[model samples]
Target: MKREEFEKIVEETIESLPEEIKQKLDNVVFIVQDYPDSDELKKTKASKYNLLGLYTGIPLSKRGTSYGMYPATPDRIFIFKANIERICRNEKELKTKIREVVLHEIGHYLGMSEEEVRKALGE
Candidate 1:
C-alpha cells in the first residue's frame, strides 16, 4: 500500500482503540514508514520481513512517576507496510494484520507485555 493509504488504515485503527486505551495516548505520534529503522531491527533481532511494526519510546512502566510529566523527546510508533503486505495474502488479511500491528504497538505504549498482547488478541 501507498504511504497515504497505510496511514489511513493506521488512523482508522487508532480511532477504533478502546476508550480506556485511547485515553492514555496523548502526545504520541503514529507514523507509517517503508520499513523499520536499523536500531529497531537490531533491538527486535528481526529479519527485514519479520517485523511489521515497531514502538520506539519509553514504555509506560519504565517511564515511572513522571510518565505524563516528562515526555519522551522523540516519541513515535513506526509501522512497516511493505513488510506487512509481503506476508499477507489479501486486502482483508492485510487490514486485519494492520490492526493487529497497530494494537500491538499500542499495547507496548500501554505497558503490556508481549504475552499480554497475545492474550488480548486471543491468539
Candidate 2:
C-alpha cells in the first residue's frame, strides 16, 4: 500500500479510539516509518521483519510531580509500515493489523506492560 493510504488508516484508527483514551493522549506523537532502525531493534529486542510497532519515552503512569518541570520530549508511537504490510495479504487484514499494532503501542504509552496490554486485549 502507499504510504499515504497507510497513514490515513492509522489516523482513522486513532480517531476511532474511545473519547477517554483520546483525551489522555497529550504530548504524544505518532510516526510512520518503513522499518525499525538498528537502535530500536536492540532496545526492543525484536527482529526487523516482524515487529509491527514501538512506543518510546516515559509512559504516563511512570511520571511523578517533577515530570514536567523541565522541557521533555513527547512520547512516540512508531507504526512500522513495511512490516505490517509484510504480514497482511489484503486491505481488510492490513486495516485490522494496523489497528492492533496501534492499540498495542498506545497501551504501552498508557503505562501498560506487554503482558498487561496483551491481557487487556484478550490475547
Candidate 3:
C-alpha cells in the first residue's frame, strides 16, 4: 500500500480507540517505517516478517513526579509497512491489521504487557 494510504488507515485506527484510552495518551508520536531496523529485529527476536509494530519509550505507569521536568522525549510507536502489507491481501485486511497494531502499541503505552495487550484488543 502507498504510504499516504497506510498513514490514513493508522489515523483512522487511532481515532477508533475508546475515548478514555485516547484521552490518556500523551507525548506520543506515531510513525511508519518500511521495515524494522536490524537492532529492533534482533530485540523482537522474530524474523522480519513477523514483526509488525513496536512501542519505544517509558510507559505511563512507569513515570514519576519528575517525569517531564527536562529533556525527556515523547514516546514513539513504529508501524512497519512492508511487514504489515506482506500479511494483508486487501485494503480491508490492511485496515484491520493497522487497528490491531496501533491498539496493541497504545496498550503498551498504557502499561499493558504483551499478553494483556492481546487480551485487551481481543486479537
Candidate 4:
C-alpha cells in the first residue's frame, strides 16, 4: 500500500478506539515507520517480521512522583508499516492487524504484561 494509505489506516484505527482509551492516550504520540530501526530490534530482540509495534516510555503504572518535573517527553508508540504489510495479504487483513497492534501497544502503555494484553484483546 502507499504511505498515505498506510497512515490513513493507522489514523482510522486510533479514531476507532473507545473514548476512555482515547482520553488516556493524551500523552502519547504515534509514529509510523516503514520498518523497525536497529535500536528497536535490539531492544525487543525481535526480528523484522515479529516486531509490529512498540511502546517506548515509562509506563503509566511505573511513573514516579516526579514524573514530569523535568523536560520529559511524551511516550511514543511506533507502528511498523512494512512488517504489518508483510503479514497481511490484503488491505482488509492489514486494517485488522493495525487495530490489533494499536490495542497491544496501548496495553503496554497502560503497564500491562504480555499475557494481560493478549487476554484483553481476547487473543
Candidate 5:
C-alpha cells in the first residue's frame, strides 16, 4: 500500500480502538515510513519479511515516579508500508495485517508482552 493509505489505516485503527485503550494513546504519535532505518530493523531482529510495525520510546512498564519529573517526549509507532505490502496479496489482507501489526506495536507501548497480546487478540 501507499504511504498515504497506510497512514489512513493507522488513523482509522486508532479511532476505532476501545475508549480505554484510546485514552492511553494520547501522548503517542503514529508515523508511516516506507521502511525502517537499518539500525531499527536490526533491533527488531525481523526477517526481511517480518517487520510490519514498531514502537519506540519508554513503555508504560518502564515509567515510574522518576519518569514524572521529566518532560515527556511523545512515543512513536512507525508502520512500515513496504514490509506490510510485501506480505499481503490484496487490500483485505493488507488491512487485516496492518491492523494486527499496528495493534501489536501499540501493545508494546502499553507494556504488553507478546504472549499478552496474543492472548488479548485470541490468536
Candidate 6:
C-alpha cells in the first residue's frame, strides 16, 4: 500500500476506538515509520523484522502528582509500516494487523504489561 493509504488506515483505526479509549489518549502522538530505528530496536530488544509497533514514554498509571509540573514530551506510539505490510498478503489482513498492533501498543500506553496486553488480546 502507499504510505498515504497506510497512514490513513492508522488514523481510522484510532478513530474507531471506543470513546473511553479515545479519551485517555491525551498527550499521545501516533507516528508511522517505514521501519524501526536502531535506537528503538535496541530499547525494545526486538528484531526489526518482527517489531510491528512500539509505545514510548511514561505510562499514565506510572505518573505521580508532580508528573505534569514541568513541560513534558508527549508519549509516542510508533507503527512500523513496512514490517506490518511484510506479514500480510492483502489489504484486509493489513488492516486487521494494523488494528491489532495499534491496540497492543495502546495497551502499553495505558500501563499494561506485555503479558497483560497479550492476555487481554487473547494472544
Q: What residue runs in model 3 are displaced by over 4 Å at the alpha carbon?
A: none
Q: Candidate 4, 109: how far from true, in Å?
A: 0.5
- Writing each residue's lDDT as its tens digit, candidate 4 over 41-103 gives 877978877799999998988988887788788999999988898999988999999989988
Q: In candidate 2, what are the lDDT values of residues 6-73, reduced to their tens digit?
A: 99999999999999999989789999999999978877878998799999989989988898899999
Q: Alpha-carbon error at 14 in model 2, in Å?
A: 1.0
Over 9-48, each residue of candidate 5 has an lDDT whose tens digit, in order, gives 8889989999998988746898888788886777777764
Instruction: Tell me the whole-model lDDT of each prediction, alpha carbons only.
Output: 0.83, 0.93, 0.88, 0.89, 0.83, 0.93
Residue ranges of candidate 1 with Cα displaced over 4 Å? 68-71
Off by over 4 Å in 4: none
| lDDT of candidate 5 at residue 50, scale 0 to 100 | 67
RMSD to native, candidate 1: 1.7
lDDT of 4: 0.89
Candidate 1: how many backbone clashes? 0
- Cand. 1 Cα-lDDT: 0.83
Answer with 1 or 4, whichever has the higher TM-score: 4
Residue-by-residue lDDT tens digits, candidate 3, 1-123: 789989998998888777987898889999899888887776676777788999888999998999889878889899999999999998889888988898888889889999999887787
Q: Could you tell me the lDDT of residue 82 within candidate 1?
A: 92
- What's the count of clashing pairs in each model shown? 0, 0, 0, 0, 0, 0
Total backbone clashes of candidate 5, pairs 3 or more residues apart or in separate chains:
0
Clashing pairs in model 2?
none
Sorted by TM-score (best first), the order is 6, 2, 3, 4, 1, 5
